[model samples]
Target: MDSFDGFVTGLREQLDGPLPGTSAQLTMAPSYRMTPEQARVEGKSCREAGVLALLFPDGSRVHVVLTVRRDELPDHPGQIAFPGGQREAGESLRATALREAHEEVGLQRDRVQVLGALTPLYIPPSNFCVHPFVGVTAAPPALCPTDAEVAHILRVPLDHLLRPEARRREPWTLHGSTVDVPFFAVDDHTVWGATAMMLAELLAVVRPLYPSLTIPS
Candidate 1:
């Protein structure tokens, strides 16, 4: 098997054990990160949402898909995010992730092999308890976004993320407070907040496979 397949195999095995959990997720969190108790109390009535980190091979390298939301959206507008949204009444979170991906980006649900889930994170601003899942599609998806929700698609190579330079920090004001924000420096976007936290956990899980790279500490 090729390196990508071997990496997937190892990732499946690792997801079976205990996750890196909050420690890994918090690595990319803003300076105003919340405590567990705060997440619980505030998240009591928070809406549940599902997000996916969809991986696939592009040429010989593995790439993950992220979406740039339309600037006019009610919630986190003009932000980089995974292709997912709130859960339906009877749908499982995994199903929600797949369904939302299909609706937003035309991802064929059946073609994706879900490796496992990462730790759930609560977003204070949106009041969403976001559940993250890692899945792999056999091939690159033929993206057909309707432009109603998604403004653009970013297919980022795993190698780019594993490099230390992709992680950067700066001061940003949120809710009238200035806080040091850690974000993934993608092409022109600042990937921070819930999306950055989820990506941090994913990198923590997959970092072992790219040991030669100087990943951010």
Candidate 2:
């Protein structure tokens, strides 16, 4: 897969530069997208967090890790998400991302090569302003899930994300209101909300490099 390697190189270069940002994030956003004005309104009241899109080589392809949270969690219960949580005092966003990944899935910080950061997303339901980072390792890390937080772990191939069919929309009920939600369907998981939105930006950045890989607008 020479083309895939080229795509990864291109993605690394793009991440080093300016990101696609909000325009890209909006592509996979829920019906009611949160605005910067709203985030500012919440201001110091909003929680700050970081998530890692930890990628690794699997056989002949590259894959990223995602987790399904336990239902007992107070926030975003039983939802698909990247490994992350609220930032600890005195920790940088990058450190927070790596630390959370280590705790949630046993992905050690030393194994990850921090690529770059993605656009910050604001989640209205949880009142969290999340900063997402992209990282890669040579091979898949030994994933040991923290039972209290993670219900299951998924290793989604990058190629799957680039497929046009991976993106789908369905009606879902949230907070007593039914809304048409777009998501990335991987295996048996329906990834939506902030996690999907963040992934949209990543795909947008890499899609152009491989014209054959159709990514939903």
lDDT of 2: 0.83
Best candidate per lDDT, number?
Answer: 1
* Worst window of 10 by summed lDDT in candidate 1: 34-43
Indicate the residue-level lDDT of 191 in model 1.
94
The C-alpha lDDT values of all candidates are 0.86, 0.83
What's the lDDT for residue 212 in model 2? 63
Candidate 1: tens digits of C-alpha lDDT, residues 1-217: 2577888898898788888888787888888784555333243678999989999988888899999998999977899999999999999999999999999999988899999998888887788888999999778878877548899999999889879899999998888999999999999898998889889889888888777777776
How many residue pairs clash in model 2? 0
